[model samples]
Target: MWIVFDLCVEGADGCEGLAIDSTLDHPDAMWVYSQGNWTHSTFATGDPFVYVQLQEYGNVVEEIDSDSLVVRFGFVKNMPTVINSDLEISFGLPENDVVSLKIYDIQGRVIRQILKNKTLNAGYHSFSWSLFDASGEHVPSGIYFIELKALRSGQREVKKLLVVR
Candidate 1:
């Protein structure tokens, strides 16, 4: 599996930076960071836009087995949800699996727990974020993250959300 991450100013000219990683480099920090949680200091000053791409390549043997599980996860239509609004999130699974989804701030703190170890059916599934934290309070405009994980398959994906008031 290869993942690419891009962070830059929205409606701006160039990308601030880019990071690419592969499964072969396991146990090491990839794209985002090497150790601690990602903070605002690591990003550009303006409203940041985040984009991620996941690709999987397999040999003949793996390819045959890969048919059993195809993972297609991301925002609906590859767009971020604006702040103070309901954000639609979607993903596809080839088989039923236990999954968890959460929202985290730039400091890697869990602000909201959308789903936790819940079973989902095979097919396209989606949920909406109300732009509120676990406490039901409105979230401040800033950068936050949406993370989804397939517990059984150990598959994890992350996307950034820029909350503007």
Candidate 2:
């Protein structure tokens, strides 16, 4: 599990804090930031001020390609969202853990398994859903729920998703 120590300054318009690497065996040796739709690799020689592009849905769609970092923790900014054709879900992880994102009906029946026991890095992440079910069929418009679960950490967060299609 990831722990966050708040370090916010008044009138600054944003909060900042030091996030130690919790997932790596050697926290000082390696750091991993996961983001965007594509994957690339980069190695840094020293402390680099990473430029992260924040998408319309939320913060930082592109990751910092580096070996170590002082990251931000416990900042989850999932969109106050509704789904028509797609939905963008964003979350923050404290460490490297197996996570699952699932959609369920109002009656608590599983609709879709977006991420099933998938391992992910500790950082903010964004994922888009096409509003399709597990069998590749479009679901009817109704009230649904989105479940984000960290398997190893035993942390779960549920949000309401309204599909208007």
Candidate 3:
């Protein structure tokens, strides 16, 4: 993610000698610090603009066998009701392998295996979760973690998700 903070000031002489300083107030804002330095531009009418740019970096991978696979997961319904929330995960594999997708609580206990040892080809695939446990019981509303693992490739990926009751 890239954040560009623009500070613009207008004056009779185009904002000459104007200085803008910024402080990050949010945890996500910390990503903007990696941009190193910011440049300021001034106009003849005493107007000035300061820009701060930052870059974000991260990798999400799902192991479906012995290879590393890229994956994406999210909640299908942003605002889900107690009986209709769903979670979705999509991933690509390199070859035919057995893949497993599991949901776990924050305590690291596996709640259920949404996808078991299923053989998949080297292509894109997706699965949707109905927010139910292994016994067909609905889990309480809260934050949960999804773990994707490929047994053949020895690769693994994990992502956080939210479930609303």
lDDT tens per residue, model 1, 65-155: 5556566644435756565588888877666889899999999999999999999977778888888999999999999999988898787
| Each prediction's TM-score versus the true structure | 0.55, 0.54, 0.48
- Tell how far residue 129 is off in model 3, in angstroms: 0.4
Ranking by lDDT: 1, 2, 3
Local distance difference test values of all predictions, in order? 0.67, 0.67, 0.59
**Candidate 1 Cα misplacement greater than 4 A, ranges:** 1-76
Residues 32-109, candidate 3, lDDT per residue (tens digit)?
222234454333332233433223222234336634544333222233223336755677666667988898977888
Ranking by TM-score: 1, 2, 3
Q: What TM-score does structure 2 among the candidates reach? A: 0.54
Model 2: which residue pairs collide? none
The true-versus-predicted C-alpha distance at residue 150 of model 1, in Å, is: 0.2
Score candidate 1 by lDDT: 0.67
